[model samples]
Target: MGVRSLPAEAYYGIQTLRALENFPISGLRPLAAYVDACVLIKKAAAMVNGDLGCIPADLSQAIVQAADEILNGALRDQFVVDVYQAGAGTSHHMNVNEVLANRALELLGDQKGNYQRLNPNDHVNYGQSTNDVIPTAIRIGGLLALERTLFPALADAIATLDRNAEGFQAVVRSGRTHLQDAVPVRLGDTFRAWAQILSEHLIRIETASGDLTLLGLGGSAAGTGLNTHPHYRQRVVARLAEFIDQPLRPAPHLMAAMQSMAPFVAVSGALRNLAQDCVKISHDLRLLDSGPKTGLKEIQLPPVQPGSSIMPGKYNPVMAEMTSMVCFQVMGYDSAIALAAQAGQLELNVMMPLIAYNLIHSIELLGNTLAALNHRCLQGIQADRERCLAYAEGSLALVTALNPHIGYLNAAAIAKESLETGKSLRQLVLERGLMSAEDLAQVLDLDTMSQLPGDT
Candidate 1:
């Protein structure tokens, strides 16, 4: 049989076969992830049918069993194809359906590809179109990736930084604005700010997830619900909710669902925000980890690899570097998603091929990057306690904390004298008799200084 005639196979056409042979990057086959998604979709589809009283009980049981086998990694051997093709993932979708159908037939003691007894398209796919199924699967996969991987890793990072804040609460460091020293802040406060940023990102992620939850599954074909049963929409969504263990609602308007790619763009935007935040944090970490000899050396990053081939004993912040790269890739993916979103035409978006690719890549990359950052960077972070304290003690900015207790002119004079004479502010204050020893100590105390009248 010609490759085109064999709908059961992935690389049936010479063009497809050639593309598969040429694109050897990511040695991992394309169908593995798709098949996993397909398995979930199939389970969801069957559950939807079962709920609507359309599927035979025995058939539903068989489909569920086959889905379990695919989920447990039994059918990956059959999924040998590249995911980066330009055909809108039709072949990819069919490949998954064929694999599941054949597997389901096997469970029923029947031959593979026997569409007469059990068709991959008619039975396995049911009312789903690649348009609906592919995007739905992308959302499902993205949600799972975030819930299982990204959120936990980010939560770990927040918790790690929170603990670091508590541990370094007393260790004061110079706070910088526009890359210049501005004020003295506790090292804990700096880490707390980072933690809060990540916490806000997590909340944004949760909000983006709501967009993913609004799926277009029942919008068969061009989102007009053509060829789909009247009741199939709600049934499939309810089933998907149960199967995926996440609440998924049908798009209220099928035409809107079919014609727009805004949800994907929204997801991309959320990821971009997260990636930008990561880049900011990584940049800060890189600066803070600058040098052991001549640079800020504010905090030491956990060294994962050698900095250079010739430089001996030089450790680079590989975790931070890798995270920054991931952020860059996420930004690129966001651009791809934006381009793909623009590529949507009249009735349906034909750019799902790239949209799915970029969406999945962004989710996986963000998840993995967060996991690595939490484990390699945030977990081992430590403050240079004495160095931080020394910097804070030497800062002229601390004079603001004393200005209310001693008038501004006196405070400025004391700060000027201390800076010129290289004397501690406390020493200068007491020596000049600007304040008594007890008064100077009280004014300099961080709590008392922070609460002094007119400080806020």
Candidate 2:
């Protein structure tokens, strides 16, 4: 207030203005999840403080109403602090406080930036500190994202994969070891395997997110719950839980919640694992859809975009490629999270800003990427049945089925002869009178070799 003349209409006061001037690092501003979470947390803190008689009821009502407007997407653009700003997200916390404070003052028929009427720290952020408020907001942001976006998207992916697995059960294809044909396997096995892996990953992500339910709302400047009532932490968390409809509990050791960025690391690590799986699945899809003429061409990926600038009728596995890129970004975000998680000195982690931004970004990107991939690429996939069977029937590993009937040496000799004479395995075996046609047919069913071929 002593520094310079005020903007008569500046909703965010001196602190937020200072942050905007200090950190111009990222052109990007804090996103909706974060801003919304901040507003929601402020509202909850005001309600709890009012309940404890720590703040006047009229002021509490004004703060809650102003914050609700922000939560409903009003004045969000006023939160203009860069995501890469001061550590522990103090800048963002102050940004939210100042905006809500000024807005509440206006609501109470006072001019904006009139701190005497409604101070940011003393009124809106009454019983909170940056340490507790920032981390609590981050948790709320992540929980809302996972519950509202990521989980439902993954469910759709799982359903699509399962349906495809059943549809492709009869498409037998050559399985390779070291890029060489090793055996025949049902094409559906690949889908089923991905479905199972993704399902497990979803469970792991959810389990990891469960840790966020424990928040550090009243842990004040440090983890000591300083300047707050004994019942403050419990009541604030209860208010948050009722408002968000989440099973939230006050963090047992406030120090642990404030100091350790371990929870964000754990959730980010879970996301990294899921991203790794997505990359693998996407790569597999790319390989299967490699070529229509010169490559494997065992399956066809949906041709959403033209593959090349020069080549005509060329369609690339762009969605799968996109999935891989998004997954890799998630991995990179995980590395940043891991580094930020370790930056805690003693009482509180100073890297909360990085952790919060990356964690929220990764969840939204991964979920949206998978959802689009399932709908645009995976669901429209088709198997090249004739190509799959041809590869399976012609594969050198078809000899493995004959290995039991014929000695290894004999099988080797037959394989060599077939290669030299340009003969099929069946033709070479039958020409040598090694087995009758009926017997060979029974033994060399490619579908059965693929996986005990139940029906086919």
Compute the lDDT for candidate 1: 0.76
Taking all chains together, each candidate's TM-score versus the true structure is 0.86, 0.96
lDDT of 1 by residue, 234-291 (tens): 8778877876688889888877876687888987898899999999999999898788
Worst 10 residues of 1 by lDDT: 447-456
Off by over 4 Å in 1: 1-34, 47-61, 402-441, 446-456
What are the lDDT scores of the predictions, listed in order? 0.76, 0.89
Q: Candidate 2 clash total?
A: 0
Residue pairs in clash, model 1: none
CA deviation > 4 Å runs, candidate 2: 5-9, 452-456
